[model samples]
Target chain A: MIQDIVTVFIKEFKEILQMRGTKRSGWINILVVIGVMGVYMPLMSGREWVTNLLNPISFAWLPFFLVIGVVADSFAGERERHTLETLLASRLPDASILLGKIAAGVVYSLGIGITSLLIGGVVANLGSLEEGFVYYPLDFLGILWALSLLLALLMASLGTLVSLRASSVRQASQTLSLSMLVFWVGIFLVTRFLPEEARVLLSGFFTPERLPMFVAMVVLGLVVADAVLISVAMLRFKRSRLILD
Target chain B: MNDVIVTQSLTRDFKTVRAVDHLTFQVPYGTVFGFLGPNGAGKTTTIRLLLGLLEPTGGTAHVLGFNSQSEGHRIREQTGALLEHPGLYERLSALDNLDFYGRVYHLPAIQRRSRIQELLEHLGLWERRHEPLAGWSRGMKQKVAIARALLHRPKLIFLDEPTAGLDPVAAVELRNDLAQLAEAEKVTVFLTTHNLSEAERLCGLVAIIRAGKLVAFGSPETLRSRRKNERVEIYGQGLEQSLLPWLDTHFGVRQAGLVNGHLELEWPGDRELSSLVRALVERGVGVEEVRRNKASLEEVFLDLVVDGDKEPYTA
Candidate 1:
């Protein structure tokens, strides 16, 4: 089963790279993504990017969007291109196929996320020669890595569930985009349009003395959501059901 | 034990429609078994069931001695399928497409490379292996798909309409290649195609289904011979269209028509040819030539599918 999952992972990774038709075009896409997240964003933020924990946290969700962009096509694209049935007909077990896809999305997004951060580090140092070489605080770096992985997995699992039922890639993408939009908008509304006293009360709940507990609670919530979505995806990824679809 | 596939009254229903109804047959080892049917006659549905991709609503199917419903992965591990579509990745090169499947089947790196090369070379696709499948012609992509199906050297393969949309020349070419590979690999093939000519040329045994029921099952020769009709082509002068009705009535002719200015007649095999000729001569029809024509598989298929004959035969 491990071998099967690895095989599928390699195949999926190769597909992600070749998704743009030509190797050159695929490379161009990679460069564009890396240039924006790794270069342009870091250049704009300057030296504060590495020293400032809030600055990196603001961009930590980059991997989440990255995963969402590709995960919607995990199953829907295969069906749209007439490859899903054949893939499902293979010898690989259900768990292997599902895990392979999730792993592909997670790894791709996290790989890009980490690479961008590393490049940002170097850029930050170069731009601020007087500050000598600098890096993200070790503890903060750990938190950022964990946050990126959880977010990537969250989106990958949720996108896969949506893709399995979607008849086309366009439909899956639309559904995923709508869900993300609603989530972000809900957050925006709560933060921007809330009554002032209610907002003060909410902010007060996260006093500096309780900050650690609040962070731990949010992490636990993310972990629970990731586990539930992944479990649902595995249960739904049956050959009989997918073949009929 | 001699059969690689055995289904006992295998059945499937889609809502109000019964896609496969009481399908029962056996495909022996190392033979090309043809599943012939028209559109919506359950050809694809049956293939899906055999591959263990779908569950049967009734009865059972044992492919390679593994139950299709409970042991599907085991069956899939031993067999390969090229379903209704070619199922190749259009964005990837032909080599990449085969390589991916090779990995899925767990061929070692060296063996995968060699096998991919061997199949592509045999199909005359080795020279253009680097081009993405999207840029290749429909026939070429189909050839690559066939190559992928055969890559792992399985004991059996299921091919559903492998040459569905190709032009005549390409279709014939694919058919020839398929025959050669099946023979060389010695793999049992369960092929589903509506092309009776293809079935006649490749399959040693075939089953015809219509409206989710088995209409007939036999060798092409046996099916053709089962029809009680003796067809004759008569080239003569003065064989007018008016004589068609008389010939149909007097000689027990089931069908008689003037085709391309010649008289063609079909009647029961029990009818005598000499008497018919004598009557034609007496009627002042100059009989220059007379020839008997054997019924083709296409004719037998047409009779069974169109006539709705539900009897099943095995030879």
Candidate 2:
């Protein structure tokens, strides 16, 4: 059993790393992320990027949106290329399949996310202005890092679950693409519409309340949810239904 | 005795529809077991049940003497599968695909390379080893699927419609390889196919299924020799169904029918064909086609599946 699970783990990890267009797109996503963070340092970190340096000339911006747009395809893209079926049928048990898929998502999403943070870190240290650029605070970057893992984990698990139940890759892909809509909607409900108390409750899902509690809950939730989803999938997966069609 | 695969009234249902209805069959070691059935006859479902891909609604199945439910991973290691579309990773090269699955089965990294090479050569996929399966032709992809199934050198194979998409040439070649594998390696093949010709040509024992029930199970010759009609078709001109009527009256040409542009009859072997033809001709009926009524495997297959199959009410 241990061998089987490890085999599933390593194999799925390779798939996450080597999935179609993943390496190339992953490279581009990494670069774009670096570029966005390189450009966003002045504005977001209000330290040496003081009010005096504010000018259209300083606006080497407008490209950060592109990073999110490009990285959006990573999870849904596997479904499009017809690799999901093979993934589902592997000797790896159902939960392992789900875990590996999520792990791949994290690698792509977090690799890009952290690379962006690092590039932003470099820009903060080497900016033209005299003020410090890590002005968002160490705690802020940590929150972003922790939240990025949570977001990637949620998306990956959701993508795989949808992938299994869908009739085709296109259908599975829709779940991933439209999920951003849910993300934006949740953001709006919490920030713009929800009462202050309600926002605090929902903020717990996105950004952890305390550092330790936040890290523990998101990591714990992802692990526990992954286990539950896999068990459910094993009970639900019917090879005849998937293969015959 | 140690049975490779055994099922005791195994049943699986899709909602109210019984996909494998109280199925019972044993696949002994070292035999090419062909699963014969028409479209939607639950052949694939039965294979899934035995492989532990789907839980049985009732009854039980054992593979390699281990309970299917709890010991699925153990069964999977010893058993291989070749399903439709094969579900290969199109992004990976043919060699990588097989190697990946070999690793899944836990072949050591050192032994994995040789095993994959041996499988690729055996399946005639050596040239395309480096090519991604996505770019290969249908036949090529199928060969890779076969290679992956054999990568771990499994004890038993559950092959669902193994030759469904192959051209006649490839199909025949693969069928020959499967036969040799069965004969030489002493490996058991659990094959599911609707192609009667393929089954008749290759299988050690053929089991015909219909609507989740086992209608017929035995060696081809035994079923052919032991069915109700026992009919044979003799090809020739000057043969008339009316002329055969005399034979029906005199020599027991039970329920004579003309098919394949020839005279057919459920003939009894008591009277020799020479005398029967002479007697018919002497009676003023023409006897140009005077061949012995040897039943073809195809006729027997159709009889078991379509004609002689019991009524739904009875089923």
Which of the numbered candidates is closest to the native, going by highest TM-score?
Answer: 1
Judged by lDDT against the true structure, how good is candidate 1? 0.89
User: Which runs in model 2 stand beyond 4 Å of their true positions?
Assistant: A1-91, A123-144, A176-179, A194-245, B228-266, B269-275, B284-289, B309-315
Which ten-residue region of model 1 chain A has the weakest summed lDDT?
A51-60
* Distance from true location, Cα of A16 in model 1, Å: 1.7
lDDT of 2 at B57: 85
Model 2, span A1-245: residue lDDT tens = 55655665555554544544455664564566567555576336634443333321122222222223323333344445544444444466755554554555556556655665555545555544565343345654565565556555555555656665666556655655677578778978767877888767766656534757766776688667756755665565555454434
Pairs that collide, model 1: none
True-structure Cα RMSD, model 2: 5.9
Per residue, candidate 1 scores C-alpha lDDT tens digits across B1-315 of 999999999999999999999998888999899899889999999999988999999999999999999999999999988998989888888998898899899999999999999999999999999888887888888889889889999999999999899999999999999999999999999999978899999999889888888878877788888877868999989978899878867876758899998988886787678998899999999999998988888887787787774344444
DockQ of each: 0.82, 0.32
* C-alpha lDDT of residue B205 in model 2: 83
Which candidate number maximizes DockQ?
1
User: Per-residue CA lDDT of candidate 2, range B208-295, in tens?
Assistant: 7778888877887776666444455666666666766676678877677778767776766554566766775676655555455456
- Model 2: clashing residue pairs? A48-A131
